[model samples]
Target: MFPFYFGYFDPTYIMLIPAILFSLYAQSRISSTFSRYLQVRSYKGITGAEAARIILDRNGLYDVPIEVIRGHLTDHYDPSRKVLRLSEDVYYGNSIASIGVAAHEAGHALQHQSGYAPLSIRNSLVPVVNIGSNLSWVFIILGFFMGFSAFINLGIWLFSGAVIFQLITLPVEYNASSRAIKQLEENYIIDDDEVRGARKVLDAAALTYVAATLMAVSQLLRLLIITRDSRD
Candidate 1:
């Protein structure tokens, strides 16, 4: 009975079903959308790296260097190092998807330069969230095994910090995507017809973050339910 209470068979597992489904759909959607746009070349015929450079320079982020890395959808901006890293496809390819992704990373660089509030807050929470994320499962498992309610509560609190981090990240990512689209359009990097393709790519990418946040919230709710059951 005790094993059943803490195992996958636990009724509380049902809470995660919807989140898991949504996450799968989000992942699939992003992949298909990105792949589709990746085949559609931008009319401007500018490589992704060039697009990023142009956008960065337009915003006076000339000091931020762009580097190319190998992988799919691995592009990101490193605020700590003040560098922009783009995946192979995004850095070298001239597709609408490539340009959109490159500009998105540049937008993150812009966010760092301007000290965007959400990005700043998310950055500040990194260390704490890292610690909490790593230790949370340990405490939760130990508490359940030892029948210690205090430990369970501590684990829940730590996990809550991670949830807050995810919540803050939503705005940061959304703002970056918005900045990317606006810059791409205003500068004529992507024309009106191409804007739809770029938007689809960015919006699909944003859904991934939404899926992540939903998954986290669902897990937190499940933990709370388990704690309540333990008390009962």
Candidate 2:
């Protein structure tokens, strides 16, 4: 039989406040920095999709496709499809923010092309992470109510997959940003001052990932502590 559960929140839930605060800070930082940089357009007036194309072509990744998707900051590189997807604003807007985002996606294409080890590992874990993300909470919640030790343990183990994925992602994302900044500078995509603003955008964006990883770790630890206390 399935277990129905409620009322796990307690003093330990307060531990999550810091992570929540950091998440909010990251969101605000990225938004403000992106907006500020967007106001300072590039000398060349090149759009983000154009920047992405330049990066791809410069890196001999001309075969890689670029597509504009409809959304806010929905840019990403799809390794499975071998395509770079940029948000509508980035695809058409000629701003530092747009170009930084586009180049970052291009950097992912470079990682895929160069066979980056972390990216490869991250790609491999995608399936397990998907499964864990979808089912871990269900297992944890049900196990807690039913006092099923095996189920709780299984759930925690699965949840760890998410933490691991987040950890793996940190280095991958930073490296991509690094590559993007370097490419932007060396290719003369943007002026020196504009490069700094572009880096600010990328750096702020990275903070969100950092906050996410911290939150995941804190949540997992809190759950483990709760389970231990319950067992005792």
Candidate 2 clashes between residue pairs 3 or more apart in a chain or in different chains: none
12-125 per-residue lDDT for model 1 (tens digits) = 777788998999999999999999999999887999999999999999989999999988899999889999999999999999999999999999998998989999999999
Candidate 2 per-residue lDDT, tens place, 52-163, comes to: 9999999999899999899999999999999999999899989999999999999999999999999999999999999997799888878887889888898999999999
Model 1 regions more than 4 Å off: 1-8
What local lDDT score does residue 144 receive in model 1, on the 0 to 100 scale?
90
Off by more than 4 A, model 2: 1-9
lDDT of 2 at 160: 94
Q: Please, what is the TM-score per model?
A: 0.96, 0.96
Mind sharing the TM-score for model 2? 0.96
Q: What is the alpha-carbon lDDT of model 1 when measured against the actual structure?
A: 0.91
